[model samples]
Target: MKDLLTTTSSIIVILFCCCVLFLGDDADQHLSEPDSEMITARNHKKFLKARHPLAKTTLFRRVQSVRLKDGVLMFVTADQNGLKEHFFIIRDKNVILVKKDAGDMPPDSIKFDADGHGGIQVTIPNTFELDPLQDLLSCRN
Candidate 1:
């Protein structure tokens, strides 16, 4: 009985050591590297330019507000000429321009004004129309 107990204990210890050696602290390192596929999948400008005829004219607009609502991300923006734009992320990689009657207007938001040479300014409600990117990095739980 003693010999059998010792043999089983030794086997278990060896298996644990092998697992520790094989798995060698790579989980954290893998997470630290920025995922290229995710970045490429999120290339919003490329997707927008492909869909819209006036995409070239609108792509230059700066980001305005990025907020999260009930796990969904909302992005609000303003163009160089003070046009307001609203965008939202429905899934991991999908972003869509929201319609005017979609929901309530975003709260007091900041946007870049071209007249001020890209200086940030407070935007008025529903003035000029534009689309923006959701601030996913800052929206972490």
Candidate 2:
């Protein structure tokens, strides 16, 4: 009985060591989330941290898509009121708050005024300290 117990313990220890050697600590990092989610979260964190000119924007709801073309990023823009179903352009110290019409293409020129859903003008600050990523994550949890 004693010899059998020792053999079983030895096998268990060997299996554990093999698992630790093969898996490593990084396995725990991806134990819950997949690789793509981790990459997306990091990118989202970088974008929301005042990379754009308009740091005053608020995240009303979760938007689906964000694309970049010709050095410009097209994504949903939100404010204190609600979310917009149109695409807002962010590029080169400017945010073109243009909305997509019911037709195929977006409007050529939106009203460039801050009174409504046009756009806002501001100087890009040296640093952006807000953590909109954490705020949005907390909402999910």
Candidate 3:
């Protein structure tokens, strides 16, 4: 009977140690994960202080935005004075600068036409596609 009790106690202690070790490893991994607010090279450009200081140019401000299909957002930002609009898009949580104005400048050349089902259909003339895996892995400006 004493031997059986000792074996049972040993098993219980081993199981407890395994649980604590597993939980400790999991908590450490969670702590090591990158924080969303932490600034990185990809997102550092969006912050005001990191931008280049120009004599006439101030900060770029978002003047207009259009919601497109599949959780995409088209943004139009202008210089501090709201002149010289720039176009961009946020797709799959990545901000992409529009390389060319495929359509027109006043409307940013990007046509956000209406779909029959009350959703936005975006039309871009040029190739604006990006490889999600490559973007995440590589350093791109």
Candidates in order: C-alpha RMSD to true structure:
17.7, 17.8, 18.8
- Tens-place lDDT per residue, model 1, 53-82, is 322212223456555554454565576677
Give the winner by TM-score: 1 or 3: 3
Model 3 residue 135 distance off true place after TM-score fit, in angstroms: 39
Which of the numbered candidates is closest to the native, going by highest lDDT?
3
Residue range with the least summed lDDT across 10 consecutive positions in model 1: 112-121
Model 3, TM vs. native: 0.28
The backbone clash count of each candidate, in order, is: 5, 0, 1
What order do you get sorting by TM-score, best first?
A: 3, 1, 2
Residue 42 CA error for candidate 3 (Å)? 12
User: For model 3, what is the C-alpha lDDT against the true structure?
Assistant: 0.48
- Clash pairs, model 1 backbone: 83-128, 84-128, 84-129, 84-130, 85-130
TM-score, candidate 2, is: 0.20
- The estimated TM-scores of all candidates read 0.22, 0.20, 0.28
Tens-digit lDDT track of model 2 for 1-141: 999999999999999999897787667767856644543654876645534443344432333344444434344545567655554444444353333331422222223334233456322111222233343344321
Distance (Å) between predicted and true CA of 124, model 3?
Answer: 44
Count of backbone collisions in candidate 1: 5
Residue 79's C-alpha lDDT in candidate 1? 61
Error of 3 at 16 (Å): 0.5
Stretches of candidate 3 above 4 Å error? 35-141
Q: Native-vs-model 1 lDDT?
A: 0.47
